[model samples]
Target: MKKFLKVMLVCVMVLFAFTLVFGTSKKDEKEGIVIGFSNASVSNSWRVFMVANYEHEVTLHPEIAASYYTDADDKPEKQIADVDDLLVKGIDVLIISPAVQDAVNPAVEKAFDMGIPVIVFDRKVTTDKYTTFIETSNYEMGKAQGEWLAKELNGKGKIVAFSGVAGSGPAEDRWKGAQDAFSKYPGIEILGQQYTDWSPPKAKGVMEAFIQQFSQIDGIWADSGLMSWPALEALKEAGRPLVPSTGEQLNAYAKFVVKNNLRGFIYPFPAWMSRIAVQYAIKAAQGEKLPKYIEIPVDPIGPDEIADYVQMDKSDFWWVGDDQMPEEFLPSFD
Candidate 1:
């Protein structure tokens, strides 16, 4: 009878021990920090590269137990909702690449008020409530391209300017910066300025119309490489000579510039900003001090510098990654 009682007591104690162990594990997991990303959009090749880098970056950190993300599709309304949804998941850190400056301000403030660490990147909000902001200086990039174009064209030429989606921060800043540079040279004429939505097809259409309207286009400038190759295509179809242009360090753009011996400059906007956002969020979550703003530099690639950045084997849209990324980190798109 005693032996039977001892056996029953042992079983109960063992069951209790197992329950405690599992209960503690479950609680720890629940308490783990979740990083949330509210990406502006995956609508273009640049964004796709950023997202791919972000996903890979998250996997390298074991401290980040889990992560969540939303694609806003370049809509402020969708981005606001995305932030709200991420909040519902009880995210410890909130990272955003805002679609619009004013529209995303309130959502970012709400996250800050909730005691969540907010890391804003690429695009920015009007408010100063976010913890950190990471971005390339759009104005500087545009100015560099503008100055190069001015010199290449001897400070005077009719040029077509292309920008990303209208109303976005980068588009606005780049346009303003280029204007600042071109304003110094009265001889430089802006034939037309159009929003390409950073779409090659859309840029082609806009360029086609510009070609029909103007007979003498001296040069071209774009906020990104999205319009670079298409700009070339438009000029080709119109039987116009290739002119001086500006773009990002895209594989295809580099190849095009080299093959044609075109007077083009590449002011790269590295796709690794997304990964840096994740890094900053994690550090902020870990109670580390972070700067309010981190500015990345633009590395310009001219004719002589094209060979250093071009990798023909990679996809046409692939740009250079930061040091943390492996040499082979680019996703295969071909």
Candidate 2:
């Protein structure tokens, strides 16, 4: 009788384990959550990384369905329409990186009113309507740039500053943070400041004009990495020495630093933006509350920090983890 009782207990445990495995099977469940992602554009490297990371999370969870919309070319109208389209699908959650803060408000507010949870990543809209905002500390990044520039120049040089797309929060905060840190040095002269509208073409024109206007331009600071690439080209074409510029365009700018044009660089927290947004959305969907402001940490792209970013000495892009590539493989993002 005792032996029979032991056999019965073993059978009971086996049955319970089978039940657990069957209950957790996603193929058997069709009523899982759907998430909608609306992006400004994936034309740039950083945005591509953001989209890839989000897609990775969706891929790992077969129970979740994701719909993606890209407002090609950073057009606000396109973004708004895209968001409306996603809303019509009745997504359980919405993820957005606005084309620009103020212009994308109506669509964001619409999603909030519908009782859909909204997660803002990287770029932000100006309303508390978003359930959470996950992005880098832009102000701190600018301050690091300021300190680096001051040290590079020995606390004295004439600087020409490039502003990107005026009134955007990141651009404005970067500018303010840099100014606040650099103002401590009285010898640093800011010859001029102007907006590039965050375009390479505009930056080219701005750089040419700066060179024409100021002969003694010793240092330059850019608020946009997208802007700096063209500016760097213009400087090379005009036979002017390149100075270190700060911006989120760290990948392209890092090549210049490695080759010696940029004395210091600031890398934006874009790739991390995706991991964070995915984690936040997953938590919120599971009934967890998040912080109102989720500021991501970032490091200035100094030579010393290169190893932490690249991980592999041979690897090319910061987004590509060392684990993704075999150690023997060549590391070239190109």
Candidate 3:
């Protein structure tokens, strides 16, 4: 009986050891890749959506052992420090959306020098030291807005143009693109152009000033549709008639366009750009080949398609066509 009991205990111990080894092997398979994300800011709705998408994508991949994120609060100095800290984490890849067009280049170049795969998304640095870049074609977005406005105005109109944060890559590229397209229609005259800092209140103030000065404006051109609602509010407050406008893909703006029967064009920058950047980073970290530049398409949402993208129940801050994930995928800060 003693011999039989001892033999049974030995067999049980062997089985336990096998189970432990097998479980560890499975865990190891799920844990190894660490991805780092350095975001410019999450102060606004668009950025908040971007970060949520990044988190969602990381959750979907078991091979991604860990993920780290740093927000720069729209400050270049903070972003530089943030990237440095991420590099020290021994991350296999770094994804960055620069706060400043040129100020964040050194940190990006440093990460590239350290042999970590670098993916630059949304914004860009002055140098091309990163491994991959994913961004929408701002020029095309602006061009589409311009063409739509021209058609609505019958190729002639007095329009005011509003740009986003000055000197940013998207602002500069979109402004240039709008200029290029508008120049084609000699009859379309851009009356005044200003930077709104992508704030509705600021845009409202600017529009109010325009209303006080100009009595017969025919259209309003805003590179980022974010300013459209505020501009419309200003027009309403001044008791002016609705005119053709150009803006971005915010649901609130779209609903306003539909409700008021306004002639406008919406070009949206996909929040999924961050997800695409992560996908590329994971692939590059796994020693897979990647394209040097992945240009996200700039498809303008016309009036006919506005209803398809608008989420009326969502918060006013949400972007249109942000259907990459369901509503519950990310919490609404509201």
Candidate 4:
């Protein structure tokens, strides 16, 4: 009886060891990749949505192991330090959503030098040192927005443009694009162009000042969805003609598009492609290879198509109905 009991105990131990090895191997397979993520601070709604998007869809995948850093409030220096730290950790891939355009270039170049794959989302650096830049064509988007404005105004209007955060690539490109498009229309005149700092509050103040100065302001283009909302709010406060506008990723703008059927396009522009960043980082972690430029396309979301494509957010197309993610995929922030 004693020998039989001992044999039974040995059999149980053997089974336990087998189970442990199997579990470990499965875990190892799941944990095969690692990524380093550096993000700008989420002080505003746009960034908030971006961070939340990362947490929900990308990070939740077991195959993707991610180390994240935040440069709160768009601080360039902090972001650079975070990238260096990620490099020190030997992360397979580097993902950056810059706080500012040019300020974040050195860190990107450093990543390039280190032989790690780099993916920049949302905004672009002045230099082409990184691998795979996934950004919307801000210039072309601006051009389209400007063209829409000109046609809507019947080629004649006193327009005040709200240029978002100075020196940022989008700011320069979109502004140039808008101006370029407007230049084609001989009748439409841009009376004032103000630096909005991409802050809604600042844009509101600028809008107020523009309202007080310009007797008849017909068209105002705020490049960002956030800035656009504040501009409209200021115009409403001043009782301006509830003019048409454009934006990206702003729900309020979408609601307005639905309510008034505004003339606008949606740029699911990877404006800080928190999701794509995770994807590329994951690819690096999985040891899969990619190219230096994963150029993404920018789509125009006309107001009429909002209701139809509100669900089923196809990843290839960035925006749906002025909001970034499809309404179907919007995870609860709660």
After superposition of all CA atoms, the RMSD between model 2 and the true structure is 13.3
Which stretches of candidate 4 lie above 4 Å from their native place? 1-31, 257-265, 270-272, 285-289, 303-334
Best by TM-score: 1
Model 1 lDDT at residue 221: 87
Model 1 lDDT at residue 113: 97
Candidate 3, position 225, lDDT: 66
lDDT order, best first, reads: 1, 3, 4, 2
Q: Which window of ten consecutive residues has the lowest lDDT sum in model 4? A: 313-322
Say which candidate scores most in lDDT. 1
Name the Cα RMSD for model 4: 12.6
Error of 2 at 44 (Å): 2.4
Q: What's the residue-level lDDT of 127 in candidate 4?
A: 80
TM-score of each: 0.88, 0.78, 0.87, 0.78
Per-residue lDDT of model 2, residues 86-190, tens digit only: 777667788888777788889899998888889988776887898998878767766777777777788999888887656566677778888997899888899
TM-score of candidate 1 to 2 decimals: 0.88
Clash pairs for candidate 1: none
Q: Which digits, one per residue and each the tens of the lDDT, describe model 1 over residues 107-176?
A: 9999999999999988878899999989998888888888888888999999999999787888888888
lDDT of 3 at 322: 60
Relative to the unseen true structure, what is the C-alpha lDDT of residue 62 in candidate 2, on a scale of 0 to 100?
A: 47
